[model samples]
Every structure is written in structure tokens, then in C-alpha cells.
Target: MRRPSGRVMVGAAVVTVVLLVAAAGGAAWWRWDTQRQPRVDDVVTDMNTAVADAVAAAGEDAAVAVSPVVAAADCRLGPLRPGKIFTGKADLYTDPGGEDALITTIERNLPPRYAAGRGTAVAGVRPLQADIGTVTLSVRRLSPGWLAVTARSRCSLGAATEPAAPTGAAPGITAVTQLLAAAGTRPAGITEQRLRCTTGDIVTISAVSERTDTGDLTDRLAPALPSTARRFTTGDANRISYRDGPVSVIVASSDDGTAITAQHTTGC
Candidate 1:
């Protein structure tokens, strides 16, 4: 995660303590700064808006997968803090070299006052942190070729929300279909996520599912792939990644078998 914003300092920390108290006691603090302090719902809404702004700046087709509002955690905007926020995943429409291209686009085209590079201390992807007034957005490479955007809201007071179903158009299912056919065992659950592109014409899709049969997933699925497909070796996970088809397909089962996820992600 990224560091806290240093603007308000002591005053913001004091306000955070009050909000945390209100979260526990249902106090009337909500009425004190109805405009300045965002409620939990307000934070989630602002996060979504920031994601949209980023997408528009990139001007690419993408898909979204959002989670419920997570309860109080360390507030990155102030000290001695707790923050409530939701995280969503989205794709940036791209071709080969798209991730870097999209990054360049965001750095050059989006509003400069809000966005800056490499915000989070998180180890994986080097994110572009954008502080768009109400929320902070982190956009970075989700995988080797996928650009995903994640937004974290500032400290707030209010009841958290359950994840709501997002609406968007579906992307091509060819890669996912190829995956399921070779998976051998049926998925315990299947879910589809989509994010509309800035152009409003297309979307990126992610079809995800879990599998219980922890068998030799790689052996069973590898032989089915064409000679053109390449395999990657990640630690412990029995899996393969090949993006030469209609979309990118990744079938990975945990070393113990309970963590398998068959995912369809947009590829460059």
C-alpha cells in the first residue's frame, strides 16, 4: 500500500479518531462534517468515479471487478488511522506494448495535479497513484500484459456495503471456453466480470471459476494446447499461461488443490 497523504496532518488525525468513535458508537459526527468527511458509501462512490476518470484518460476498452466496502483498516491518508474502502480490478484496452503505452497516456493526458507515479509500497506492480481529491487510485500492471486499476477511498464513517453486481457488456468467450473444455473437472462456481471501455463500444472480460479436483491439472491440460502455446512456471501453483488464442487463459491450482482459479483475462 501507499503512504498517507501529508496535507492536513494533526487535524485530519483528530477527525479520524472522532469518526472511528462514531463507527463504534453510532455518534452524531456524521452531521459535523457532512461535506468534508465522506461517509463509507461516499468513499466507494468516489473510488468508482476515479476509476472511470482513469479509464477515460487511457481511452481504452477495459472491464471491472469490484469488491464490497472493506471495514476499517489503516488509513493511508492520515496518522493513527483507520480507513474504509473497496477495491475493484479493471483492464486497459491494449495491443502489444499496451501496458507502457497506457502508462504514458495517463502520465501525459490525465490531470497533473492529482496523479503521480509509483505510489504504493506494495511489491508486485509499480503503480501510478492518483489523488483525485476524494479518493486515491492506483493503476499498474496486473500481469505480464494486463493493466489493472485499483482505487482506495479515504477515511470515512458509515456502515459498509455488500458487493453489488456491476453492469457491462461481455467480451469474447473463446479463450474461457477453450479453458473449461480442457479443465477436466467442473468449476464449483463461475462468475463473469466486465468493464466498459471509454469509447463505450467494447469491454474487457474476466471469466473466473474455482475447481476442487486438484489432480494433475497441468498434465491434463498441457497436452491439449497447441504447439504454439507457451507455458510459464510459477512457484507451487500447478498451472499454465498462454495468450495466443481469442483471449488469455490461465488455469492454476494451488499446490494443495483448494486454491485453483480458472481465469479469462484480456491480453495484449
Candidate 2:
């Protein structure tokens, strides 16, 4: 067998280095494309913008870019009717910090309102934990416009809560999450808990407890609530009101007994 010369060895080494460099460059470009936020126009443009911003702000490895729930939505925001809904969802690779990191990134990037110039409306984040927890946000358009962002999600996310003014808003998004955990039989027991801090502060805790009879679901959850809270019964809805510093907490239950909600309103 003939031995290779020095020239052949040198050429092979140089080719190997070039291949490695190309691989690295390709990886970087893929990350940028996957994480870059999406842009839109008119109706609910801010909605798409907000979700995209939140995912990019997350600083995590997201698998895909922001995508419209409706394909045509890419052209412009849709559902130009009152109470019409538009949704967008993006998935993120989990970070070492767990849910806290995801929640913080979302709250930070998530917009408080659709857009200042669009009109007068509010936006809020409500976090829900099922097999895998999710956060959902809703935007209500106060005036007739071309855009309305109904819901958006990052990670394992979902939404449920009424829109409220940002007056005397809760301390932070973290506090709102803490409140939800404190007022439940179990975090998993509450299927949906939404927190909105925009023009106003609102937190809604919804519980569908298997431990209690459907007829007395509210009765079961009321006792588990913070002792400082004053419980009020409005027909079938169980409303629990409490104050922590400037934030006023109201926990309510649906009359049907399937859901219990907590709202930290803007005012007492």
C-alpha cells in the first residue's frame, strides 16, 4: 500500500474545518428564522405582533415562528364582526427555569393593550395548567376597527378571564400566579385562571373540581380560599373578595357549578 503524502493530509484537514464552519453557520441561521417574530396588518395586527414579540422576548429556543390560526390571516387581521375571535399559537422548547421562565418571558413581551393608536381596549394574560400548563390572552376592541386579537398562546397555553381596567393593578404577573395557586384545592384542580393587568387589574380563577359534587363545587372551593377573603354568593356564582396591598381580589364561581373564578379588580 502507498503511504499518503503531506499535501494530501493538509488538504483533508482544511476541508474538514470548512465543513464544520458551514454547519455552525447553518444552525445559527435556522435559529434566527425560527425565533423571529411575525408581522401583520390592520385587524388584530397588534395581536399577532404581541405574540410574536413575547415569543422572541422569551429568550428560549422556540420550534416555530408565530403562525396565524387562519391561513389567510397572514394577509390581514380577520373576524371583522363584533365578538369575532382570532387566535395564534407558538411552541417553545422548555428552559431550565421551568414554567416561571416561560411565564416571565411572556408577561414581559406581551403587550398591555392592542395598540395605543388603534383605539381604547384592554389586554390581559390568564394562565392555565392542565397536563401541561398554558397561558392565554384576550383583547377586546372598544371601538370599531380593522383588528381584534381574541387569543394568543406560547408554550402550553390557554385563557379564561373577564377584561378589567388596569387601575390598582396587581404587584406583578408573578403575584397574580401566586394568587391563583393560593386559592385552589390544587393547582391542577383549577382548569383555567386568567390574569389581566392592563388599563385595569383582573384575575379570574376557574375551578372544576372532581373532589366536590357538581351541585356544590363552589361550596367546596370557597373553604380552601384564603381566610382573609370575604365570600359572597351571587345566585350560584361564588365571589371571593380580598385585598393584598393595592390589589383587590374577587374569586367567583359559575352558577352551573362547573367553574370558579377569581378577579382582582381595579377598584375595591
Candidate 3:
């Protein structure tokens, strides 16, 4: 009888020791898991602040104050190539106003693009949680201060979708288009203002204002072109040459017209 009782006591002691070891192992793992994640408070705060600034800048007549609440925050951290991505829901509260109008106002106020240090911010407003709108925001890293080019969808694996290759046109063509959008058609007299991109090892961009003062056009456009590039002038012809990544662009112009050429190959 004494021996059996002794054996039972030893069995209980062994079981207790096993349980203690398991608990300690679990605690260690929990600590490691928590440490692996990034500190996200700063990111969340910046996003919230962006929303507030947008609202304040709107200055709508039907003014309504908005408050944002972030929920279900999930973030993925990586090294260099592409940076971090943070996704969550942004809930907005506004003073009593029609939902549609409030939504429209908020959308109008939101920044077209928020530079999140090479990250993308995708916040979609939807009528969720009892007719109040909620925005699911996604911030993905691009380079150092811009959003990712490829948008995030529910099915994406967090990899940046490769951008489609250009149609072999000089990049300057796009720059000229944007400039035109801002400068608009030359003041009345300039009838034949033109821009052309000829692609090759050296992409050439030509801007001509027929029968118009090239000086006026150059003055208007020179301000629009990159000021950091090395600038040169010859008589009526002004030239700004610079390297944009692997491509070298030389923009030459006069009061009559302008020509921009870019090259990526050796010599010529």
C-alpha cells in the first residue's frame, strides 16, 4: 500500500513539470512574435492627420467637421525594394448632414495622392456599419515619398504590379502634355503651337510656335521645364540639357520654336 501511494505521487509530480515546461515555451514564442511586428502608431497618426488637413482645406459652405477612426490595422514590413504597406478601415463622423453630400465633400477634399514615403494610400468610402461611411485605406510604399503604382485589391499578394512599358515614345511628350494643361493655349496670337516626340537612342522633343515670338513661348515653357538641368543659350536658341535616369534630354528653343532630344546610347 505504501509503495503504490509513493508511485502515484511521483506520477503527479512528472505531469506538473511537463505542464510548466510547455507554458514557458509558449511565453517565449509569444514574445518573439510580438517583437517581429513594426511600431505602427506613427503611421496611423499621419494618415489620420492627412484626413483632417484635407477636410480643413476644403472650406465648403456646408461645412462639417470630420473625425476619423482607424480599425483592424494590418501592416507588412519589408526591406528596401518596396517599403511597408498598412491597410485598415477609416471611419468618419460628421455633424448631421445628408449622407450623400457629406460623402461627396469628403471625396472632394481627399488628396488625389498622399506621399507616404514611397507608399500608396487607398481609402475607399462606403456606406457601411449602419449608413455611416467607412473608408478602407491602404498605404503601400513606392520609392521614398510616393504611393505604389499598382493599386491593391482584395486578391493581390502584396507584390507591386509591374508598370506597363511606354509605347516607345519620348518621355518628354508626357511632360509637354502636362505643361500644356497648366499653360493652356498661348495668348491668342500663337496659332500653330506644337510638341512632338521622336523616339530612338536619343528621344527628341520638338516644340514649335509658327509665326509667333519664340521668345514668349520659350519664356513660358522654360519656367515649366526642369530648372535643375544645365542651361545654355546660343543667339535666339536656348538649350537645357540634363540626364533623366539613363536618358539624356537636351531641350533647345528660340522665340520661334523649341526642340528637345533625349538619348540613351553611346555617342550621338
Candidate 4:
């Protein structure tokens, strides 16, 4: 059989190039599609819910602290996007269970719509990654005895929206007010988020503030806490936290690593 002419071969090459470009365009669209919510607030809110569910699956024995829905929401998109990307994070420490073992448990416990992802191992610890659409929940070890579970969303199209302020008196409001007063400097702004946990407890992450100095902040602010408040030490985080009933006040380094920040959480 005779081989095709050079002109025919070039024609075939052009068609292949066109098909490749179309396929590439389609893949990019899929990467940016809104698989779930259409706004940044809604994206982080759903992520918070997923993190809360993972927390419950982690069981009551683990010492859990969650990121503010807005703080862990650090990802940004273009001005005209319809969705946003962010990671809902939780630091789990003081659990007797093996880290990988616990992650496996969480993998099994998330809603079944989440199929397992290609388990990638970082530092020999493979994250328990499960995905539903572009949203994923991943658990991995951060350090010795400290594990972090993150629910991350894809970069889709969305506009950024600040969460609405609490309408009623949250349980931790008084404590937050007192702490802010002791900080002695007015915050630039704050984000108060309330995430509903599957366990029926409303996790109110409130009174988040802009950056301030770390210079003995806890000592200056210790007097403001109620007598019921007692401390819990999280290793090397350069912060202080207290538990009073359902209320927790945490003063940690700001996201920029420039200054201290005070925030509160009401619920586990």
C-alpha cells in the first residue's frame, strides 16, 4: 500500500493540533467549574462543615482546635471569578491513636460521595484523601504527635464575601470583648464565623482580629479571662489558649507572621 502524501499528513497534523487545543480548553474549564457553592463565603462554610464532620470522626479523645473559616480561607481568585479556593484546617494533638490509623478512620467515616484520591505520601505519611467533586478532605501528620486535617476546595469562579456578624450574643462574646479591651489597641477588622457541626454543636469562631504585637500578650491579657478559664498548651505555636465551659480564647501569631492575633471559639 502507498503511504499518504505529505499534504495529507500535514492536514492530519493540523486536525490533531486543533483537537489537542480543544481538549486543553475543556480541562481548564473543568478545573475552574463550581462543583459546589458559587461564593467564597459559601465555599469556606461548606469546608468548615466537612472539617467538623472529620473532627467528630476523630472521636472525643483527641484534643481538637479548628481554624477560622475565614482565616484558613487564604486562597484568592481573579476579580470576576464565581468560586474560591480555601482549606479548612484543624490541628489535632494529644491523641493516643497512631496518626495514619486515625487518618484511615476519618477516610472511612466521611460521606460516601467522597471517593478516595491517589494517596500521596509526604514525609512517609500518606494523607487520607477523599474527594467529592473538587472538594477534598485530607489528613496527614504535621509533626510528631500532631496531625492536621484539611478540607481543601478547588479554584473555581466566585466573589469574595465577608461573613455576616453574629446576630445574637454568642457565648464567647463577653470573653472576646474583655480580651480585646486588654489588647489595648483597636483591631483593624474582624471576622466572626459560626460553623455548624454534625454533632449538633454550633462551633462559633469569633472575635478574630488583625495583627498586633506578641510581646507578652497573654500576660497582659490574662487578667481579662474569667476565673473559670484554664490554659491549654499547644506546642511551639507561640500562643496561649484557655478553655472556659464551651468558650476558648486563642492568641496566636497572625497569618503574615508579623504580629499577634486574638480569636475565640465556642464549642468543641
Which one wins on TM-score?
4
Best first by lDDT, ranked: 4, 1, 2, 3
Looking at candidate 2, the ten consecutive residues that score lowest on lDDT are 139-148
Q: Per-residue lDDT for 1-268 in model 2, tens only? A: 9988999999999999999999999898756754442322232433434444444444432211223343222221223211223354333323222334344444455445422122222332223211111224432321111112334433211122232323343343333345445544322343222222333312332233333223343454455556654332334324334443333444444456554433332221
Question: What's each prediction's TM-score?
Answer: 0.53, 0.30, 0.28, 0.59
Summarize candidate 1's per-residue lDDT along 210-231 as a digit string, tens digits.
Answer: 5456566777777766686444
Candidate 1: clashing pairs of residues: 4-76, 63-195, 64-195
Clashes of each: 3, 20, 17, 6
Q: List candidate 2 stretches off by more than 4 Å.
A: 39-149, 152-199, 212-268
Q: Regarding lDDT, does 1 or 4 come out ahead?
A: 4
lDDT pick, better of 1 and 2? 1
In model 4, which runs have C-alpha deviations exceeding 4 angstroms?
A: 1-46, 59-86, 90-126, 141-148, 183-188, 208-212, 218-230, 256-259
Global lDDT scores for all candidate models: 0.54, 0.37, 0.33, 0.63
How much RMSD separates candidate 1 from the native structure?
Answer: 13.3
lDDT of 1: 0.54
- Which residue window of length 10 is worst by lDDT in model 4? 69-78
Report each candidate's C-alpha RMSD, comma-separated, in the order given.
13.3, 16.5, 19.3, 9.7
Model 2 has an lDDT value of: 0.37
